[model samples]
Target: MKYLLNSNNNILNKLKTKNTLLAFDLDGTLSPLVDDPSNAYIPDTTKCLLAKINKFKKYKVAIITGRSIASTKKILGELPLTIIGNHGLESFYAKIEEKEKWKKRCLILSSNLKDIFDQNEFFIENKKYSVSVHFIKKNRSNSTIKKLANTIKPLLVKNEAIILGKNVVNILPSNKSNKGFALKQIMKKYNLHQALFVGDDNTDESIFEIKKKDIIKIKIGMSRNSSATFYLKNQKEINSLLKLLNDVQTQGINFLCMNMD
Candidate 1:
């Protein structure tokens, strides 16, 4: 992936377009990854930049995350932006019955999976529509975690899907909905044609796969063979990127006004 710097004139030119959608992954993109997910919050500087962008008529901002809608809303605390949660299964404006159905299945799976591994070996997080088996806190060996995943993988039924990330395994309904689908839906709803998407993990890969010429895909940190076209050195760089976006939008608006004059 190419390093995204302010000197990249080509990218800066593309970002200046009106009707652009600015999408971000919440946990590792907008907020630093915390040991406890409940404590995550958007940095004040970044939040201010996002608020400014949201106020622009020609620009739209959104948060797309694997978090549940209610959880994301609670942390964000009232923002004029679209939120796509549960890896795209839940949204700010729509209620999905499938989420409730998946919650039941996840509970059952969590109970059965717990039987195979020692209860203290890992922690289970039930996110209503999805379940996450977290091995991070336990400090289990990599091989041990792999073995546990292998044992649980076979137990998944046809309608269930599993994705591995960092030291966690997430089980969710195997539906057509994902970050890519959610991004497309949001763009379509707003009649937007250009988008800048920033994310940090494998879950964000789906959004990177969207084959749109105007889509700017930015990965938060380094990864092997990431599909994103650009990379930010780390989460700390997210603030810099947001500031640049804010500057670009301000420039765009000033240019429009100058043209009118």
Candidate 2:
């Protein structure tokens, strides 16, 4: 993948004005990656830039996250950005029937998982619309993944999906509930001409794998396996990117005075 900061010219040339969706993943993209998800919060510097970017009328700013809507809402209080939660299973516009369906599924999975895995082995997060099975000990993550994958298979519904994140396992519905599917829905809903999405893990690969030219997929941490074409080196660079984007979106992209190394 190419370094997004270095390719200022290409990045500037590709970005458009109105009907452009500027989206981000929450943890490890907008917020620092912490051992505990609850501790993850948007840095004041990054939050300010995001708030400004959201105010730009031409672009649609959104948070497409694996985070549950309720939890994300609590963290992003009064942000006023479009939020696609539970990897798209829970949203502001989702049908009531759909929400109830996932809620039921989560409860069952939570109960079933609790029977087999210990609190130390798996820190289960039942988000109503989804379930995340996390490892309590960082050193045991790789081994824990093998155990998690095997243990969850029989307990899961045929259509349910199991996705691995940064040392975490996410269980949710597979029926058009991935971030790619969510992004497509938003693209259609908003009639967006193009999009710029930034994410940091396998969970975000769904958006990166979208075979479309209009959507610019940027990975927060560079990986050769990642389908994203551009990326920031790490989460620390997120604020810089957001600041640059805010400058572009608010004042319009300037080729001459804006290129940063």
User: Which candidate has the highest TM-score of all?
Assistant: 2
Query: Judged by lDDT against the true structure, how good is candidate 2?
Result: 0.82
Q: Which ranges of candidate 1 are over 4 A from the true structure? A: 92-95, 138-147, 252-261
* Model 2 quality (TM-score): 0.92
- lDDT of candidates 1 onward, in order: 0.77, 0.82
lDDT of each residue in 29-84, candidate 1, tens digit only: 88888876778898777778778778877678999888887888887876867888
In candidate 1 the C-alpha lDDT for residue 21 amounts to 87
**Candidate 2 at residue 235, lDDT?**
87
Lowest summed lDDT across 10 adjacent residues in model 2 is found at 252-261
Per candidate, the number of residue pairs that clash is 0, 0
Give the C-alpha lDDT of model 1: 0.77
* TM-score (C-alpha) between model 1 and the true structure: 0.87
Model 2, residue 226: C-alpha shift (Å): 0.6
Provide the RMSD of all predictions against the true structure, rounded to 1 decimal: 5.1, 2.4
